[model samples]
Target: MFKKLKDGVNSLKKKVEEKTGIKEEEIRPEEIPETQETDEKPIDKDSDVKDKKTSFKNKAKKFIKERKVILSEDDVEDPISDFKFDLIENDVAFDVAEKIGEDVKKDLVGQEIKWREDVGKIVNESLRNSILNIFTSEFEFNRYIKETDKPVVIIFVGTNGVGKTTTIAKMAKMLRDKDYKTVLANGDTFRAGAMEQIEKHGEKLDLKVIKHQEGSDPAAVIYDAVEFAQANNYDIVLGDTAGRMHTDVNLMDQIKKIKRVVDPNLVFFVDEAVAGSDAVERAREFDEAVDIDASILTKIDADVSGGAAISISYATKNPIIFVGTGQSYDDLRKFDPEWFVEEIVG
Candidate 1:
């Protein structure tokens, strides 16, 4: 697909060059005027010049219509390099941009493009596909999800303000709508509004949420939620952990303790897609704290230019299980690779 676009642009460049030469050949430097008996003119130099100029104009117009130039790599000192720099400005990693530029060049070098078309379009599509392909890397979420017979606990873990609780709520809503007997564990006992935010979603979904008082032990809250799910008939339990800096060892240890208590079926690392490379760095810390079964990419709808969605799974080696498209529960998507590819490429 990218090759075709590059070829078209190169062809346009060639045609433009050819048309310029043809136009020059059609024009004359001097002209003669027509003879007029009344004026006693020997020749009409001015009239002839005007006629030739009009002729050249018509020919040039025709040439422009028939021929267009397709820009080549040699036509510019560094076309793909400039494009890569633009990508970096858009928050794509330098290394990732370099790889994309190489891929674009490889696909474009030998291709034949049509005249008058912009090669940048090809570059854009190639870059888009390259990024979308990262999100498309598949994994078996059902493997971990179906392994447990009792209440399958899923702990949502991430740094502070990364939409961890909201992602938990979205998951709970999904499970509830599927008739999975869902329970939400508000284990984020540190944040002031964390419990309230989670409870709002729980109320909307009508799912039972277990939350302890603020400043309580998050691990104990998770333990109680697990026990509650087990005692009841709930099939799915989603525990929300307090968000903190990835570098904070104390908070990391707290999450580790919670994982020990719940033995969750999947430890989901929720990160905002707009955070770019920072999202990848945070994932590393969170994954080190617990056995993360998968990842959930949040705020994708507002993060069109960010590459975090593309880079996170590649960095962590954890498959993206879900993508949050918006704040509503219905906005949560199951992270279909095909759909992602289609939407992004189109």
Candidate 2:
């Protein structure tokens, strides 16, 4: 994919260089010297140096005018299909990519066009529609805290190594900043380093984190965490569950048990944007195991195209509550559908 982008840029550079008889770097209109025309004597009145320069400039402009990010008609029966395939190759799920492309096509059909100047606008609008399809809206945080009689419980679930713990910390920070007293439930008691990592994050954020020893029952941990929150009158409770493979029945059953105990208001399927199609597959598995209230897409900064962000939201019909753009606690942000759509198509 990187190679393809580089090849495209190089090809354009070559085309410009061949026509202008100047290096690609020197072709910049602002960088070119103004006195080069006067420095040389005119050779022919009919077809002189000025004429050659004008011809080259025209050729260069024509080449640039034809530049396209999408494929030509000869490349495939459906350019949209080809573009969707490219998106899947960028880590977007096949179904999701297809849906996005179809949505774009639907939005574009029967649109009035006066001139070719609208081509970019049409493509941008199409891609924007595709992105809008993927973005899930976040829950109203203030409403959740203020309206609920019981402490709002948020359970973070995903396959191992998807930054569930880090995301919990970030959310806790957000809650604290909002002046809501938040508690962290260290439900991930299986891995050796899990407790310590979550504990450190809790310490850094200056929030209370409840944890048990290694090999402890995860369900019990969550139950006790809820009890602690209730007793202490915590505004919110965030649980960090043990990372388990979606295929693990024992783990899934345990999660179901925990869900019964806490009955959380929100169950977030935390995923990395780099996972793309795999993220969708994992999300389906997790949703089947437990009711995923919403989604939280992590590692957005790591993804250049962000196909996973679009795919998960579109696939599950679950709102994306937050996006983790970096490893820092401050990188967490609420999902914005409009901005996301504009960025994708543009």
Q: Give candidate 1's TM-score.
A: 0.72
Q: How many backbone clashes does candidate 1 have?
A: 28
lDDT of 1 by residue, 1-346 (tens): 1222334334433443343334254343223222212223324567977555555554444434454434355643266666566566555566766776677666655444343344445545555566665655576655555566869888888877878877777777766776788888889899898888888888888988899999998888888988998899778888888888889888788788888877777788998887877888888778877868688988887775545655666667778888888887787888776665445444
- Report how far residue 292 has shifted in candidate 2, in Å: 0.2
The per-candidate count of clashes, in order, stands at: 28, 1
What tens digits encode model 2's per-residue C-alpha lDDT throughout 1-346?
A: 1233223223333432232333432465444445444335445658766676765554344335443223223222255665666776766778777777677667655544331233445556666666665664557756777898768888999998998999999889988998989999999988989988998998898989888888888878877888898999887889889888888998889898888887888798998877777888888888888879788888887766566766777677788878898999998988877756545543
TM-score of each: 0.72, 0.76
RMSD of each: 9.2, 8.1
lDDT for every model? 0.68, 0.72
Name the regions of candidate 2 deviating beyond 4 angstroms.
1-77, 134-138
Position 88, candidate 2: lDDT: 69
The lDDT of model 1 is 0.68
lDDT score of residue 333 within candidate 1: 81
**Model 2 lDDT vs. the true structure?**
0.72
